[model samples]
Target: MSTPRDLMIVALDVAPSRPLGRGDLSLALAGAEAYDLLRTGTVRLRGDRLAPLTGPGPDRLAPLPPPGPEDGLLAEAAAALVREEPYEPLPDWLWRRGRGLSSAYLAALEAEGQVTWERSRWLPFRGGRTVLSDTEARRRAAYRWAADEPVLLALAAAVGIREELTPADPAVTDDTALTVLAAVHDAVMELEAVRQRRALEAAAFANVWRGA
Candidate 1:
């Protein structure tokens, strides 16, 4: 029902040709969370920085309202908001909130019965694969994916799925949503760069050892 959950279901249901990296998916899920919170007026972007919406107060900056009870992970995310001046930048928020987010969502889905593990018919003793259950949540996510909803499509593209709507498509018109998508893209690329740098370092170390 939530954007992050819907994106996770879409990823599993679509099963893209190239496997998605968990890190990349986690970053996009964080972006999806930001998008949903923005849609609900829980947060807002001030020129690429994220700030939680506060209620009226004498100081003009009250505490953030609580997240809905149904989404515990989102509650945690809301609590993690940087509620001071010089609020956290969008890309930094994505990297911070996205840590291990994919695993958290997967565990939540499994516990909620939204996903189930099914063993292969031919290999009874082997490990089973988790699949989405036939539920309204899955159906709604599928419909959104089929419709190429801009937010979902942009998140999917950040995770390297090229089959759906491109991020450049004019479907997403909201300036705030577009900002979230751009931050997600930048974060993913930064993560990829880190991975490449680490790989190169490892290769150089191995070469030095071999020469010695």
Candidate 2:
């Protein structure tokens, strides 16, 4: 049987088999806590499994809000696990349209020596000549968003519970825990879909904008 964490990692496209960073570890723990809580029944997982848990549907015209501070921290952690940097400080327009953390943050982290950005460059890896395809860039962004979603969800739920996020909820049970996990699964899927759609749109727009 696949554990909740395993399902989440796959859904978020995170390679859980690799080592993790502090923030990534924290997020993973938080996800585990949420799973436990749901399993124990401390918090009830309500609403339709397929319904939007916290954001608008994928087909909507309005964009979702960019990730907040918690998201940034979690994303940083996840990227570190992959030996990459977390993207950040996205453009205002994209943020308003619900773009998550900016890829710039990861670049900034790499420059700061907080984490390594893995990829083959034109020059030596250390010579700063790494080459990255648009698809690779999009995948990185998706992973960051996926890893951060659980953390954000737990934090938001914690606000109502008046407690810190944890792996075990005093009030959740196995059945309900699965429901909550499903909610998380839904959120990750939505985020990934949005990221891919935006990337495609951006690529097309770039081509048109450049008269290519």
Candidate maximizing lDDT:
1
Worst 10 residues of 2 by lDDT: 82-91
What is the alpha-carbon lDDT of model 1 when measured against the actual structure? Answer: 0.80
lDDT of 1 by residue, 30-135 (tens): 9998887777767766642233365321111112465532577777777777887756777788988899999999999999999988998998889988889999
Highest-TM-score candidate: 1
**Per-residue lDDT of candidate 2, residues 1-212 (tens digit):** 11222223232333333332223322233444344333333222333223366653222111122331233333333222211122221111122322222233344444544335454556444544223333443455455445544443443332221234466533333454444334434444444577689999999999999996
Angstrom error at residue 115, model 1: 1.2
Q: How much is the lDDT of residue 104 in candidate 1?
A: 93
Candidate 1 residue spans exceeding 4 A from truth: 48-70, 119-127, 164-170
- The TM-score values for the models, in the order shown, are 0.83, 0.30
Give every collision pair in model 1: none
Poorly placed runs, candidate 2 (over 4 Å): 1-31, 39-41, 46-173
